[model samples]
Each structure stands twice: as C-alpha cells, then as structure tokens.
Target: MIRRKGCSEKGRRSPIYRVAICEDEAPIREALLQMCRELLSQLAPEHQVEAFASARELAQALADGAPFDLLCLDILMEGQNGMEFAQKLREENERISILFITGSSQYLKDGYSVRPIQYLFKPVQREELEDALRTDLRLHHRPRTLTLRTGNKTTVLPIQDIRYLESQNHWVVVHMREGQQTFRSSLSEVERLLPPDQFCRSHNSYLVNMAWVAQTGRRELLLQDGSQVPVSRGYYESMQRQFVRFLNLK
Candidate 1:
C-alpha cells in the first residue's frame, strides 16, 4: 500500500491536519509544499504533508489507506486535470477540505462546484497563503468511537473494530471484528451517528464502513470479511465514490 512513507504527521495537539500537494511542475510543486510546511508549522504544528507530481500519484496513495485531512490540487496536467479529479473526489467522501492551485482563471467558475476551502494562483503571495492556512479552517479530527444502545445495555465501540451495519425490520445489526451486536434503531439514525467521511449507505438494507470495503462492483460491495453487500441502483455510483473518499483511492 505504500511506496515510500515520509514522517507521519501525528497531531501532538488538537486541530492537527493532513495535507497534500498535487502538481505537475516540480518547481511549483516544491514551492507549494514549502509554503504548506511553513504555514502549518505555525498553525498546525503536527500536520502531515505530502507532495505529488501528478493527481494520479496522490490518488494512488489515498487508495492505499493514507489519511489526508486536506488536499492541495493543481488544475492542469498531462493526464487527469485537477478540476475533473476534484469532481470525482466529491462523490466519495465530502469531509476532506480542498485547496486548488492554478495559473489560469478560466477554471475558477467551474472549480467552485467542488467547494474548495481556498484557491491560490500561480506565483502565490505569501500573505494570501498564510491567510488561507491561518484564518480559514482550524479543522479537527473526529473521534474513532461508535455509541450504540440495545435495551438496558449500552455499548461504546471502537469504529476500527466494526466492519458494517445491516438494518432489519426495526433494528440495526452491527457486524464487527469480534462478532455481531444488535440495537433497536433505524439505519438512518445510525448513519447520522457515524462520521460521514467513513461510512456510506451501500443499499437500503445496509450501511457500510468504508475502511473495511475490499472491492466493489455495479451491484455489490466486497468487504474484508469476505461478505457481499448489495448496492442499490440509486446508490451505486455514490457508493463507489464514497469508498474512493474513504480509501483515498483512484
């Protein structure tokens, strides 16, 4: 899953971030990464950052399970451009904030559809870069816990340990590494409780944890546990996108 791993940006305090820079030009790419490091050093002391020559490389790393809180993407390249790539990213997970870097103003109107946190133009000014990092978002990581109640007993489980959840008549069954647990609740209710960036509605009967998903097809999702879950026609593309966001995949 990893080609080469740099320093792990484990947040030493609250409001830590994971950031990436995807640019085709080496000079521009290094400049952006340097700016990020300088700003993050002041704003988020423990942020993890990475640089990529193309969008494809960044997408591959995400697929391999590297967590990125923010992605700094470029708009033009030899292959998949940043605007189209960002659109694809939106379909998966919607939590990672994006910052687009480009030399052209033509894509501005079109790029806004993906809702980037900010935009930095070519020859980016240090003041603007500083403002974007400092005054904008002070994003925080979500806690890895799932709280469920089944009658008189209540359970607070680690999110990483759970695989998926299935909804029956009036209850939801949680399938996890240990086994299964059931609680009287609707799938919607459970979905609301879980982090949107990590879970998705695979079908009307199922809510899946994106981390455990192995493979996906037009009609079903394969989980690490070797179980197949149906993917409703309405949610097919969206489900794939959600998995992409979850895995940070291509």
Candidate 2:
C-alpha cells in the first residue's frame, strides 16, 4: 500500500518505495519485474519490487506485514483474479496505488471499481508501462524531511506533516499536525531548505503548505486546520497560482 511514514531517523534523506507485481505466467511476470526494476532504478534508486505468481502469494505477503507503495497486477490469474484481490485490499488499505495489466478490454469497467491508476493491455509496451509507473511514482512521492535545530536538541520533521512555518523574530515556529516546534533559524534559511513547489511564501514572515491550504483570498488563507494565515500583497498572486497548480496535480 502507499507507504507514507514520518521521519524516523536523523541524516537519512532518501526514502525507499516498495512495489509488487502479480502475474501467473512466468515469462510475463519476469518481464514485468524487470521493467519495474529498471524504471524504478532510474526514477527512485532506493526502491524495491517483489514478484508473485498468484494473487494468493501477494495476499500472504501483505498479511505477513509486507509494505508496498504500488502494485502492478495482471487481471486474469489461476484462482483469484487481480480485480478481486484489489477489492479486498482496498477495504483495508485505500492509499496503495494499483496499476492493472490485463489481456482484454472487458475488465475495464470492473477495474474502475477499485480505482486503479492505469490499465495496460497484454503485451504491454515499455513506453505505456513507463508512463503508468511515472504516474504512480508522482502519486506516491512526498517531500523530504526538514531537520530543525532547537537548542541542544534536534528535531526531524516530515515535510508532509508541516502545515505551515511562522517566523517569530530570530526563531521559526514549525506548525504541524501534531504540535508546534520552535527553532533558532531565519525564515529565509528555512525557506531555502523546503521544497519550493510545496511550500509557498504567503507573507514576509509566513510560509504555508499548499496541501494544507483550504481556501485562499487576496489577504488571507484558510487552512484545513481552521487557522488563518496572512497573505502579503506581494505574494498573494503567486500563492494563488501555486495553489491552483497544486490542485491540478492532485
């Protein structure tokens, strides 16, 4: 499933994405595994891909606490089909991205029931499969963690959990879903470390996460947490544009 997790350690930057492939045919299964491994090596070098010859095997792995960021499943199999397995998996884990590889177009309607990312026909083309994998990566990828230095203690915060950043004189306050953490750093310095596309400079002293923003106006932004952040005139237009672009991506 879409394995999203918070920062667990210090100084670790790259996050590994785990992918799985399920196809009964030995040749097709091997081919799919190779394609996925090759593409992920270029896109995300720290990724992993596991191949299963049947849906039951994949299900057993999941039951054994195996985590997967994406699943490349073939629709038809020996006992349990891909669509049936996907439906069962979705009940427990809805975050995982599924890419269906089917032999016929008849399963197209049923595939949508589980909300798959894309469907590729039999004898899948490398280009089409690559495109589907790219989409899955985009949906699964998240911004890196932000290391905050607070006095003698250091705090590592996942960028995705941060709702906003506020500048209070020489100190910066990191507002997150859990709580707030104050650190000695300038707003500009913190801005430089954050991803430009995810964090927007709403005001001279405030940087807001577009993902947490619910509504935007000329002067203020309403966040999902019901907090209002001021939007400076200089950054209002840019904030609006960025928010729109972020929405389109979602």
Candidate 3:
C-alpha cells in the first residue's frame, strides 16, 4: 500500500510510485529531475524517480519490467516523439499514468486517446505539477474516509461510498447507495478527491463512478441502480476511451 502525507489513517501505504521522465534537452531534462526529487520529497518521501534523455532509453527501461507509476514525457525529441513512445507504452502497459510536458498546445487534443492524466506546458509551473501529483496519488491510492459536516451534525463517510456527484447552485450533492447528501463544496473539489480511473465527469453538472456503470451509449450512461446520466458531447470521446480502458476491453 502507498501512503500519502495528507491521506487518512485508513488509507493504505502505496507501493513506491516509480516515475520516469523522458526529454532530449539536457537542461530541461535535468530541471525536471530536480523538480521531481523536490516534489517527491515533500509529497511522497519514499517514491523512486528516474530520468532518460530519450524515449528509446525509457522504452528499454520499461521493457525490463521496471514498474513505473507515472511517466512525464516531452512531445518532441531527436528520434521518436512523445506520442509515438506513449503508444508503445500503452501497448505494453495500459495502467501506467501518463502526463505530457510540451511547449505546444497543438498536441493536447491528441493525448486523450492515450488517456493522459494531465498536460503541462513547459516550463511546468509548481502549482500545475503539484496538482498533477495529487491526481496521480488518487489514481494509485485507495479512497480514504472523510468526515463531512451537515447543518448540525458531522458524519464520517468512506470516499468509496460516493457513487456520483451533482452540482447545485453553490453546493455539491453527493449521491451514495444509501441516499443523496449535500456538501458545501464545488464539483472540482470533489473531483480532486476522487480517483481518476474510478470517476469521470460525464456532464457539466454531474460526475459518475465507472464501477457502477451498467451500460454506456454514445450520450448516456446507465448505472447499476438503473439511474441514467447524460454524457456531455464535449467529453464523449475521452469518456468512451477511458471507459474501455477501465473495463480492460482494449
């Protein structure tokens, strides 16, 4: 089990989150290595970090069965670009979390097929990198129980108990198997707390758990409890790809 600094006691300690960064530029590569070391020290003290000057080097490392939790890849390089390398990585290991570090936004739309966790514009910002780390942590770590407050009472709920979330005017409604509970938080806030592989934003106002999905069509998702949620057209393709990956279908 992997343990994160701010995680609850019930949360299991994660196995070392081994990471690899692939870049061709010496200065950029070294900078990323330094940032990774600093961030891991603060957020995941026991994590392991590795660096490669090119995708070929990283690919060789991966072929050796060296488990990597996250991959920070650059879009352009001397030989194979990040996209091509990512394709190979996906073919080899579908579960590894990928984040692209690129100078251009042109490749952003193309990253969805690979199901990248996030895209960081170089030079990466501290806040952006930290946010990406938080996302990665949730993906690798199990959900923890959280204490939430109602009008006059405090209730402890395991994060896994939440099946979906809906946004109201200013508050978010958490829907569990038992019933719906209102919480004073934004949808984005709730999103940040949930695991990326388990949860997805289906609509502007709704987020659904893939675990409870009974069926999914082009524009809707049917939950195990017989609830149907609409999937926004904007997120349709990305959601479909993720759903397939989640089901281990391809």
* TM-score against truth, every candidate: 0.50, 0.57, 0.53
Q: How many clashing residue pairs are found in candidate 3?
A: 6
Ten-residue segment with the worst summed lDDT in candidate 2? 1-10
Poorest 10 consecutive residues by lDDT, candidate 1: 1-10
Error of 3 at 115 (Å): 0.3
List model 2 lDDT by residue over 1-250, tens digit each: 0122322123232356688999999999999899888877655646789999999999999889776778889999989999999999989887778999999998899889899999999898997887777666656555466666555676778887899999999888889998998877788777755655577889999999898998999989999989999999999888887778667656
Runs with alpha carbons beyond 4 Å of true place in candidate 2: 1-14, 144-250
Off-target runs (Cα >4 Å) in candidate 1 are 1-15, 139-250
Model 1 residue 204 lDDT score: 86
| Clashes in predicted model 1 | 4
Sort every candidate by lDDT, greatest first.
Answer: 2, 3, 1
The CA lDDT of each predicted structure is: 0.75, 0.81, 0.77
Residue 174's lDDT within candidate 3 is 78
Q: By the lDDT metric, which is better: model 1 or model 2?
A: 2
Candidate 1 C-alpha lDDT tens digits along 1-250 = 0011122334322234678889999998898889889877745544677999988898999889777877888898879999998999999867667888888998999988899888889888887886565433323444456656556676878878878899999888889888898878888777755555667887988998888888998888898889888889999988886677556421
